[model samples]
Target: MDVPALLDWFDETARDLPWRAAGTTGWGVLVSEVMLQQTPVARVAPIWQEWMARWPKPSDLAAATQGEVLRAWGKLGYPRRALRLHAAASAIADDHGDVVPADVDTLLGLPGVGAYTARAVAAFAYGQRCPVVDTNVRRVVARAVHGAGDAGPPSTTKDMADVAALLPEDAAAAAKASAALMELGAVVCVARGPRCADCPVFDGCAWQRNGRPAYAGPAKAVQKFAGTDRQVRGLLLDVLRDTDEPATKARLDRVWSDAGQRDRCLDSLLVDGLVEQTPDGRFALPGEHGAVSPRG
Candidate 1:
């Protein structure tokens, strides 16, 4: 697969992301992985830097109120991830001596740490030789090895095995290779408008050999945020975040026109623990119901 060529290209062209910089701890890598999920790198980088500066260690983050974390999270969308990360930080502080776990199995035990996240932390942060498959890696593998245009519905077992086989035997090299493959898929072998001419392994690509056929697998669902419950939820949270005091029901209602939908979204936020209702029936971010000054 022209592994050397690919690695060399990565060595020269990899983005200067802060999380990948020298001396970044496992905690930093964990945070980057979580923030990068379904979010763009451009959006996550600044927030991640802010998070690292504010909460340098798991213990530091664990000590913060949920309101502080959510406020720090800003408009990263998927606010639940912030709460999950807070939960993970608390668990790390209480159980793991404030150190992010290096082993995949133990990492999997943390809140919101799924198989992909566990493997990513192990390989990228700890330099372990393990498969760290993501959408990019899956797409690259589908074309490079299987001659398929796109990866179909995800099968964790098969995806892990495919990537595991491609990794180098040496731990450090394998980790770098995993990162390189991900970078390749992200920038070169992208879902649309792939730049085959610039690909390091262009000569050996199976999909190119097969005439780069169109993907005929099951259609992937396109996610829409406008007019969705997610947008309404964001609006509701925005009001709570901007206010230092609990917002009244009337204030919350102003954000969305549909009373039924607004009420449902607010109720969902309360259930998710992202928002807390005060005794007076006003709503605020978690831990900010009666605080002197809300962090957000």
Candidate 2:
């Protein structure tokens, strides 16, 4: 790979994301990584800015109630991630001296910090030369290195090794290269209608050299949002999130028509510790149902 060429392209074309700002801390990078999971960057930016301002450090977030964290998370979808992030904040504050750990292993120990997230924080936040393999990075590697039209099923061991090999020896340069590869996949070597004309490594791209064959790998599952249990859960959570007071079962019923599904979703929410039943049998976000007063 033409590492210098790719880095130059990234230097000129990388998105000016707030998380990439010089002043962003490890906590800021961690929050951005979590928020960016399966969520668009545009939607994450404003929310990330709000979160950074409201909870600049893990301790600040640790001090907040889970209910407050969920409310701040808004409609990011996967409300469970919000809960996990809150848990991580508590761990970081209490166990890690209120600091987002720099090492991948220590980062993985944090709640909800997976392989991709751990490496991302290590490379992007700490400028360590760790492999940060996300979907985009995988795609870029599959095409550029392996000559595959698209990345097949994820193999953590192989994927990490592939990216690790591509990284420059210098830690800072490797970090920049990781970011550059991700940006290239996101913007130029995109899954659909790739703008190969703008690709920095076009001449040397294995997939391009092979005439850009179509992806013939295993079919990927298409996720549906409408009418799924996830949608129902989001609807139920929406009702609780919009209100400061507890919602009656009857009030929650209005969101979904199927009594069984609604009840099941509600039960799941309660089991997940996302919602709590008040002494009066009303549903409220965690920390809002007990002795704690609702935030203004």
After the best TM-score superposition of candidate 2, give how far the Cα of residue 170 lies from its true spot, in angstroms: 0.2
After TM-score superposition, the amount by which residue 262's alpha carbon in candidate 2 deviates from its true location, in angstroms, is: 0.8
Write candidate 2's Cα lDDT for 1-296 as tens digits: 88899999999989999999998999999999999998989999999999999999999999999999999999987888999999999999999999999989999998889999999999999999999999999999999988889999999999999999988999999999999989998899889988988899988899978888889899999988898889999999999999999999999999999999998888888888888888787889998668333222
Model 1 lDDT per residue over 78-121, tens place: 98999999999999999999999998899999988898899999
Stretches of candidate 2 exceeding 4 Å from the true structure? 291-296
Q: Output the worst ten-in-a-row residue range by lDDT, candidate 2.
A: 287-296
lDDT of each: 0.91, 0.92
Which pairs clash in the backbone of model 1? none
